[model samples]
Target: MKPGRPAAGSSHWLFTEDRLREEVTESQPALLPLDAWHRARGGRMVPFAGYEMPVQYEGIMAEHLWTRESAGLFDVSHMGQLVFSGDGADAELEKLLPGDVRALKAGRMRYSLLLNEAGGILDDLMITRLPEGHPFGEAGADDLYMVVNGAVKFDDIGTLREHVADRITINHMEDRALLALQGPKAVDALARLVPGVADLVFMRAGAFDWQGVPLWISRSGYTGEDGFEISLPGDAATVFTDALLEQPEVKPIGLGARDSLRLEAGLPLYGHDLDPEITPVTADLGFALSKRRREERGFAGADHILAERENGAVARRVGLIIDGRQPVREGADVLDGEGSMVGRVTSGGVAPSVGKPIAMAYVPVAMAAPGTAITVSQRGKVHHATVAAMPFVPHRYVRAGA
Candidate 1:
């Protein structure tokens, strides 16, 4: 870990701007399409996932609070967008993920995980089946649109290529830029530019045209708010982002606030909370494994995962509410009542929204229940905390008729 930065676990990285810039400046890191635009607006550039992206513009705390109350625009072009097509696309995807892909209706999105042979997560991704008769560029309507983490996209693509049959075509949409518009007023703000956007229910997606620019939008986000993820041509990114900021409800956000927002939502960062060694059951993400898929047991590592799901995993990921004001950083040792080391913090920090210290960690199943007592040892100081139900703040995902 870099000095003065939190050593968070998994693939989720917590990087300080100076350290990040220092490491990548020597490597000539690639710049995002909106690189210059961000620089012009006081965006502090940092190296993340091979892209020089914004860490913050105003500040993490303010950005986080603003996103919760209004809307925040985020540049997530660093993520990889993939379109998989073929007659057997759903079947092919099912072989890789334990999701009920075959039953996925057109224009619906599903949060799924790519599992290895051992049921350990390769990466957590969003999968959307394009509306029938709605083709994405060269890909057909039957194609499945997937968005994966930037850090592991290459590895994910390679693994998919190795496992999927030849008929399945994988087209990497590298020419696109992804943006997230999140918060309570997100729908109202976006609808001003793209009419009918407010109609997209949670977990739903559609292809729409905004000011002559084609957009593939999904009503989903990592912030656990009612929001949208827009995929547009790389060249149109700056213009679109600028347009969104024109609204009083929207402000440009950086990755620092993005991390805190997700953490407070009880969402796990891929690298920090999930890894090749962690399984869905262990991560408390068993919902990603569809029920029918569980019965069929055809996906990778089904044998072990099914057994673990039935009998219970040895250790499980859970939320912790620290008793004091001091925030605990990741890698801190978690001790049971007897003070024996039982686990370690994976992701933790001051939750601006929650107004207290909250963390996520793995502990033995017996100690994973809510209200369980635990102690964290960080920097030679011991702090008391209790197991709590996650999303320290309640998720505000807008559901239909709500």
Candidate 2:
């Protein structure tokens, strides 16, 4: 299985066998078995990430505010989970990525990118080294667990198989479901359901048993809050979710609010801020390139990535704070102080937390720094804007000893 080009009309550059399904129709909605769980809780289902997921239990704005103030439950089962293992697994993975996967300690997780030979990001993902005692980590199989974007799962899996075919084994965890519980009070709310999880530090993951159901819990989330992403068998997903929601601090949130939250957190969305044409450096994700990896230059596109790191890239991704109540959306032109077109907005919305319109765009490196005055063209109007620091809302990740 060699990595091949994505199918026609596909959003990603690659595809997986399991991801090839007929188009979703109103008569045959793509509902997960857990649909009954959401329906029982009064959730409104909508298509998202290629799966029919709950958009809200109450409402977007209410759930959004509650998460910010407390905790919110989100069904992210649509995310693709795959296991890669065999001899030289790390080495093979390095050939396709720019991250330092070999250095990741067991029980730790890392955010990395799958890159094409040209250094363009195919998809961003989270990889974790399963602990020695884990089921996936038996002798003769050195395994790496991955969670990828649902929209690109098929393509992503194909790419992985092609790159490491015969050299490694790839297993898609289709039996599992992913759930994200996020917000300032996420730890406190989850503690009552799964004790000791609140103590896990950012980027750390481990297996735990909750009421006889096993779960892979990671102390991480996209909301820039103290939160967790739990992976468990599909059969137990609703059971675990319902238990968490029983806490008064937890509410159900939707994709609309999820988008706004990540925007405010300065996190990049794959198809929007990241794609096959965007390299990590130009995407302002150079931090994800480990220091050792930069020095070693063993990963794919390392030559170009290292060169850009040393000499600096021509274009840089940046955050923008727009004036007025009107929001500037993706594809909006970004202009310099003199009103010359400089770039384009990749993602934007009225930030629920910031109480104003915010956006992210890529501009000439010279104009990417904070305090740079700029203009955004939206609906034929030029709006006053400025280059702002990311995380329109400050991150509140809980540290190990915090």
Candidate 3:
């Protein structure tokens, strides 16, 4: 699958079987700050999220396995970096999102969603509380850092501005770039550049300076592996990326391997596995709503979302393991024993780390349990698949310590 397909709430790209190639042919893509850097490193460029990005550097399989074993540097600068600051920062944000914003302590990050009035997911995002001290002067004491998907960032900004602009100051960090260094050796490799980086636990964030450049580093990632996402000045992107590549364990990974890695990790790509039509409950992201928010029902779409939370979702997202090497792409219909349509594949691909064809789909709750047998209809061919436990590859997130 080529890049340039419409991505959902998260930052990863989706490759629809047939529409991608044709759509990108007619689309004009913008270049990233590290565009020339990627081209110089032999990256196969493709249009993605309205920007030209590397889909593969060496190759998807090699990059995916390399990350699982060693470390891989991903250029995810296209994601939106936003800062919200005000006197009532937490309270104001709580009105829009379902997460318990007030509970987020400084240096901690939480995964959350932007919802519509009807309880549909507007977008999924990561919110982190910056430390009390504002080192770079980008934000003040009462500020929060948010990372949203690039494709819908403008729309997300507009929506946020419309609602909270009058009260909170929204700062779009357009001059920043984001990078993810993931895998088993990720910490070992990153610690060499910034010694204190490894000290941060999973989902914790802090500010550090590399030479004179300031970086907002978070010990979290989407690949289900122990990793870090560093937000730095866009001008320093190439320099920092080059420095990381200098480490023997780190290699440049592209969108293709990123997609496959996330698939194996059971993470959903926004436009594919998540959309405006799907609520957090149906998307298997009920945890993002938080305990207090669930009970209070204070966020947008609280009525419908709370109802689904209490009762149940019409359909639930689940993992599928295909029997053969023929990779199942998105839009394939999932069928029951009698060939009745039970669900549809949202994100399907060859999982290099798992060494199998893995996919995610929304299916009837009755058939969503692991070990349930299902069939996938793809391109006039029927293939046997089974509902399996997600994160086909186990997650290796770093806890508080050790």
Candidate 4:
């Protein structure tokens, strides 16, 4: 709702560098550990998630295409890396997260939602249990690791503290810097630097050491590519990044490409596609709800989410393919054939990889089927669109099926 800024939903959504910088500069946003490094590389800096970060380097389109074909390094240190410790960690986590923490094997992670009592998503996150006998700093092996959206990290921490028992300790790993290396050639570049990283399968994490500095790596990322997320001491970030860029395949990517890549992957970003008003079922993220947890119904918001799961939610998120050349921005109104506004778009743009304008929106369940006709109204212009399956471009995560 700020003037001249794109109403792209999330704070990390679409932004023009000048306007974004103007708005965030007055706030005195904190700089990333690699702040100087990004500037030295010609990264166009913008304010996002209370941090001065890069929105694009070479350019969004070129960077996006490069990441699809090769590998792109992204500085995502803004995301909060939390390590949960203490007695009954697994059981305590299950009380808030919809996923089956107890059933999760060591060194594995799963996408999960932090739900309130109403089943509405507070935040979407990934939870990983450390490998057996693998301890993270002062935390024991049984401690759990979580990566949460940076924009809502403080709120997420507050939610956990208020809900989980006193024995559980939430350590915010702010001193660490997180980096994501993504694309088909990611493994080729990463393996050369860290030999054993090639063994980590999708959704699995492990502990490693890089030049005397400890690293916690997970073979998972936001761009839906076969990649890895590395957590290491902030001081080592520059050196490690330098080494990775030395590879012929790796390049520093910015936020613009990151957003487009995730959109094309059919991944919903927190705060934009997801919020307190949207449940897992409504967001078309039922897979995050584990089979065992669904039967037990012990997690928060289980009652409403389960009922919606069984009977079907009134409105469900679906993919939309715009019929024209121009892209549809978020906040566009979704209209039925009769012209009544039925829903709205959450994330949308001209998908660079797909070469078509694609979007994710919420609409009546009856109109959610693929091939259904829909209308989008943006900036006083009406555009025709069709309901379609997501991932306008297919996901290429390594070991996705395995």
lDDT, candidate 2, 1-402, per-residue tens: 011122223221111121223245456556675788888878777665567776666666677778889998888888898888787787788878777888877878899999987788999999988776664435343678889998789899999888875868888988888899999889898888888897799999887888888788899988888799998898888778778878988887866677778888999988778888788999989988988888878777888877887899888889998888777777778777677777888777677778888888888899899999888776578887889999799999877677
Clashing pairs in 2: 1-162, 14-155, 15-154, 15-155, 16-154, 16-155
Q: TM-scores of all models?
A: 0.94, 0.90, 0.93, 0.94
Residues 276-321 of candidate 4 have per-residue lDDT tens digits of 8899999999999999999889999999999999999999888999
Which regions in candidate 1 have their CA more than 4 angstroms from the true location?
A: 1-27, 133-135
Query: Can you give the lDDT of residue 263 in candidate 1?
Result: 90
Tell me how many residue pairs clash in candidate 2.
6
lDDT of 1 by residue, 1-402 (tens): 111234543322333453344333356778888899999999988888788899999888889999999999999998999999898889988888999988888898899999999989999999988875553686475788999998789999999999998999999988889999999999999999999888889999998888899898889999989899999999999898899989999999998889889999999887778888899999999899898999888999999899999999989999999998877777788887787788878878788888888889888899999999888888678989999998789888877788
Q: Judge candidate 2 against the unseen true structure and give its global Cα lDDT, from 0 to 1.
A: 0.79
Q: What local lDDT does model 2 show for residue 337? A: 66
lDDT of each: 0.86, 0.79, 0.84, 0.86
- TM-score, candidate 4, is 0.94
For candidate 3, give the lDDT. 0.84
User: Ten residues in a row with the worst lDDT in model 3?
Assistant: 1-10
Alpha-carbon shift of residue 10 in model 1 (angstroms): 20
* C-alpha lDDT (0 to 100) for residue 55 of candidate 3: 83
Error of 1 at 97 (Å): 0.2
Between candidates 1 and 2, which one is better according to TM-score?
Answer: 1
Off by over 4 Å in 4: 1-26, 132-135, 400-402
